[model samples]
Target: MTSALDIVFAALADPTRREILRMLLEDDMAVTDVAEPFAMSLAAISKHLAILAAAGLISQEKRGRVKWCKLEPDALRAASVWMQSFGQFEPVNLDAFEAFLAQELHLPTDPEL
Candidate 1:
């Protein structure tokens, strides 16, 4: 049987859902606003949102007539803890990972990079 963590990992596996999480990181947004940047239909975005909601990555509430989506940052704690367990094998150096990402993306390295 699939666990909640399994569901969350599945939801986060999608690039669109990951982007949605990033957008919500800044602030809550109306469903329409969340759908704006994507090329797909609102229905498609809603499907992605539903997956995220099920994963506990986000929560949706209706206020007035608008349905808003908010990021539940704490929801990631489980995943974070699971990832930390892997640290027993090797330490996670975020700075080095960031530099690696920059190199792979062909972005310039700097104090901010």
Candidate 2:
């Protein structure tokens, strides 16, 4: 069975969908405004938007005669948590690494070299 995480990853796998999400990051936008920068037909952009909505990455609502799309930032919390878990290791210190390498190889650490 496909989990919500799977759906989110699948939705994010498409460049078009990723771009749409980036655009919506600034503010909510009308459906036509979302489609403005793409070369594809409105129907194709709608398909991308549908996938995003299905993944819970975006929410769509009608305002007056126009439909608007908004990014749901919380939808990414799961993915972000999962990804951050892999960052358990401390970041490498380049200077310390260079010193260790020099010691191991019996090389001088002089800046002139």
Candidate 3:
């Protein structure tokens, strides 16, 4: 069976949905307002919102005539925790890692070097 984390990760796979989450980080917004910056039609934005809502990444409610969307970050706790598990490893510097790789492969460096 699919877990809730599975759904959350799936929903976040889209760049548009990721941007929507970032927008909500500031404050809740009217559904139309959330759709404003995107080139897609309101219906398309609504579809993305639905996927986010289903993933528990966001919650929506109607205030008067306007439907507002809010970020539900609690849904991300599991994913965050899972990622933090990898924190035990030392952070690697890319330049050092690349040099190590070149040395291991006996690859020639630039003539200027």
Question: Whose TM-score is greatest here?
Answer: 1
TM for every model, in the order presented, reads 0.81, 0.75, 0.74
**TM-score between model 1 and native:** 0.81
Q: What is the C-alpha RMSD of each candidate to the true structure, in Å?
A: 3.4, 10.9, 9.0
Q: How close is candidate 3 to the true structure, as a TM-score?
A: 0.74
**Displacement of the residue 17 alpha carbon in candidate 3, Å:** 0.4
Off by over 4 Å in 2: 88-113
Compared with the true structure, what per-residue lDDT tens digits does model 1 show for residues 1-113?
99988988898888788889989989999999999999999999999999999999999999999999999988888987899787752446778777756754466666764
What is the per-residue lDDT of model 2 for residues 49-106, given as tens digits with 9 covering 90 to 100? 9999999999999979999999997999898777879875344767777775675446
For each candidate, the alpha-carbon lDDT, in order, equals: 0.87, 0.88, 0.88
Model 2 per-residue lDDT at 42: 96
